[model samples]
Target: MKRVMGCHLEIEVIDPTEVELQVAVSGAWDDGQVVESLRCTLDGRAVDVREVRDPAGARIHVLDAGPGRLVVDYDAEVTGRARPATGTAHERSLYLRPSRYAEADKFFGFAATEFADVVEEHGDDAAVLLPYVAAWVGSRLDYVPGASGPTDSAKDTLLAGAGVCRDYSHLTVALLRALGVPARLAAVYAPGCDPMDFHAVAEALVGDTWHVADATCLAPRSSLVRIATGRDAADTAFCDNHGGGIQLHVSQVHAIVDGPLPGDDLAELVAIT
Candidate 1:
């Protein structure tokens, strides 16, 4: 499958600051299936964006830009059947614990009741719990754009019972972690996403592979292009600045697939490539 995606941002930096853009596709792209036509610029000029790759190969572009109006534009075409990862215990210890937004520990009681009987009946399988958690979260929440805040945790989302993609992902990750499954948040470029923009989904470890559990089900999980993955949104924000203030004048993102979107099967264990 082929996918095209990009984002445009206009920001007024009040002071000198360190900025990082986690908007590029993962650096683990297969060499043979190369269709990666990508570019990033500031004020129509090429900016020095250094590449940083995590242990898992997600890409983060970092640059120190000025106290001026910076227009950052990026676009890329990803062409390949994404490579599959063999699951390992290396990241399990980190993902199983509660983080800033996930707060898995806070949701343990709610999780016990939600999956208690199901676990007894199905024998505590991640494959079974994955889809069940996704469906449960989907049923509880409404897809309201402004219903959640940046600082909101899984507890906050559960109380509100309404949120966008990231919120749903946060809650799903927390709940799965509470149920003893190592799960984390992934920021991806989702082709065929409704109200298209960068999307976030919950990814859980089941046996020897990482499977996506998108409660929102906004796009086909198999078509998702990985941007960044972490404990939660904090580690995968599209734009983050360390110092000074930045005013976002304009922000836009678009993504689409080459042909018609593939049908999404929540029951299937699909990994985000």
Candidate 2:
């Protein structure tokens, strides 16, 4: 299925600041067919943007801008489904480690107590564990918009029992990591999302292939288009500023499939396109 995804961001730059944006669809899917574009402007004038590609294919748009109204626009028309591929040794090792939001190390006890039996039965089977983790997380947390903050961790979500999509992804990723499955988070454009914003979902490695696990279940996993990916939200945030200050004033995201959105089968392994 072909999907159209885009976002508009309005920001206030308090001073001369360096900005990094991960809002574009990843270049990992550069198969000569996907169409995408990104533009940045400050006070109606185009800003000089540098595109830096990460090892995993994330494109970071960087710029140095003085105080002004900064706006970013991105659009992508992604065609075809993602191809299944094996995880590299480095990827397997890296994602298994705990990160800022997905605190895998801190959840060993909780994982053992909550999912030990599933592990024993499925034995690192991502197909089974992925759905199980999604359901488990969906049951554990309430989808409260302001229930979590930027600094909240999976441990925090587990305690509060309420959060948004990122929080759900963090806890789901952490649980899978603690259960001996290499897992990470993917920030995506979800076509059917109720709140209509950037979404996060957990991805786990199973038998070499990586599969998505959306605890929020806010949209069909089959229709999600990947924007950025990492061990947690810290690595995949839409925007970041350093050595200066900026405030996001407005953000609007949109995604739509060319045809009807396909139904998702959580028990099946589906990679984010």
Candidate 3:
């Protein structure tokens, strides 16, 4: 089996003040493998870790916070999980809650319009629709790391035609939802990636299960790792409620698989500075 890993960061601070925070880390991997376990530390203090598994992928979240300089460390090893055949309608429709879809006035206009068209054009088949959208977004946008924020909307990305993974995933989710597909964003640490590292991806409910797809990875088939998922990047953010200012520094390491190595397995890492 092949493996990939990396890390990322998202920090914002305005000055001196107390902050509340919660962070989640996610990635994708070959299914049917056992994720040995994961350990995470925040601000030099150990945080609580939670695990959740779904058809789309497996995820781990670190919930904790303190004062200035938030530091984090995490490691997990996942084995392959069984996957069901594709081409089935999603059992449920994801309802967009008012509170969840905040800042509608800004996101609903052009962003929603363009996304709706894309979905409508490819609604008939998942195989065709999924990759088409993924490639379209990845190819159309330039990966400009450190130039976007959590609140950046689909319109912002569409206008600039360049952004980080969060922007890419957000735009993808918006478009998927507009086309009547239940879609969400995932925050993950890629173990071996670098530069444009720690990443986010988009997932849409197709057939009876959720299928993972990232425009950034150009529709990561079964190769990419799995992490956490939420309605958008905000829901699956790496850090919790932090009020003061935020700063992020992320790194990754990708290696050709030869055998098991000690320490961390996933390439994605997230750090708040």
What TM-score does each of the candidates earn?
0.95, 0.96, 0.63
Model 1 C-alpha lDDT per residue in residues 198-273, reported as the tens digit of each score: 8999999988788888899899888888888899999999989988778888888888889998998777888877
Residue lDDT tens for model 2, 1-273: 789999999999999999999999877675865888888999999999998998777888999999999999999888887655458899999988998888888998888888879888878777788889989999989999998899999999999999999999999999999988899998889999999999999999887878888998899988988778898999999999997799999999999999887898777788776
Give the 10-residue window scoring lowest on summed lDDT in candidate 2. 79-88
The lDDT of each candidate is 0.85, 0.89, 0.50
Residue range with the least summed lDDT across 10 consecutive positions in model 1 = 33-42
Candidate no. 2 TM-score: 0.96
Using lDDT, give the best candidate's number: 2
> Candidate 2 lDDT (Cα, whole model)?
0.89
Which ranking of candidates, highest lDDT first?
Answer: 2, 1, 3
Superior candidate under TM-score, 1 versus 2 = 2
Better of 1 and 3 by lDDT: 1
